[model samples]
Target: MVLVEDALLLAASAFIVTSFVGLFRVVRGPTMPDRVIAINVVGSNVVIVIALLAAAVGEPGALDIALVYALLNFLLSVAISKFTVERGGVL
Candidate 1:
């Protein structure tokens, strides 16, 4: 059980690092779609980290929060994509 918790922590750390990389992309992306993709990547990484934390801490509520966060992320991505398209990529 200790090993499992340790592994989850490590995985979460990796995901956080990945999210930082995605953050850089979001900041430096040359195009709107690229920034959107970066945002999705970061959001998914955040969800993964939250799920891992829930497992590591034995918190059921965190899992539920993570699920809700995932849904919001998806919806936000879709909305941004639609807005960008409608705006003719001005975003």
Candidate 2:
């Protein structure tokens, strides 16, 4: 199982790289919506990485937390969208 662990670790590292890229884009974005989109992308990657870590480490309830984080991400996006529309501004 060492090989499998190594592969998973590699996958996790790639995901982290993507997450950081997304974060950088968000920080340097030219528009509010662009930043929001980056945040959403980062949230999704975080969810996937969390789930993978849960599997790799055999951690109980890690998946549950990931799911919760995923749900929160969805809600945040929706709320931001609504607020933007209501305010006639980018969010």
Candidate 3:
């Protein structure tokens, strides 16, 4: 049990680090679509991290929060994509 918890924490930490790296693309992407995609990727990484932490801590309530966050992330991506398209940005 201790080993499993440690592994989960390590994996969550890795995802958090990679998400920070992905933020660079959000800042420096040459196109709106590229930035939106990077944002989506970061959001996904966050969702995974939340889920992993929830599992590690044995909190089912946190899983519900993670699921809600994942849904919000999807909606945000869709909304941004629509906005960009309306503004003449290519998909």
lDDT of 1 by residue, 1-91 (tens): 9999999999999999999999999999999999999999999999999999999999989998999999999999999999999999964
lDDT of 1 at 12: 100
Q: Which residue pairs show collisions in model 1? A: none
Error of 1 at 3 (Å): 0.9
Model 1: residues with Cα > 4 Å off, grouped in runs: none
Overall local distance difference test of candidate 2: 0.89
Please give the clash total of every predicted structure, in order.
0, 0, 0
The number of the candidate with the highest TM-score is 3
Candidate 2 least-lDDT 10 residues: 82-91
Over 1-91, each residue of candidate 2 has an lDDT whose tens digit, in order, gives 8788778778988999999999999899888788779999999999989988887888969999999999999999888878877888853
Model 3, position 80, has a per-residue lDDT of: 96
Tell me the tens digit of each residue's lDDT in model 3 across 1-91. Answer: 9999999999999999999988999999999988999999999999999999999999989999899999999999999999998989894
Q: Model 2 off-target regions past 4 Å?
A: none
TM-score of each: 0.96, 0.91, 0.97
Clashing pairs in 3: none
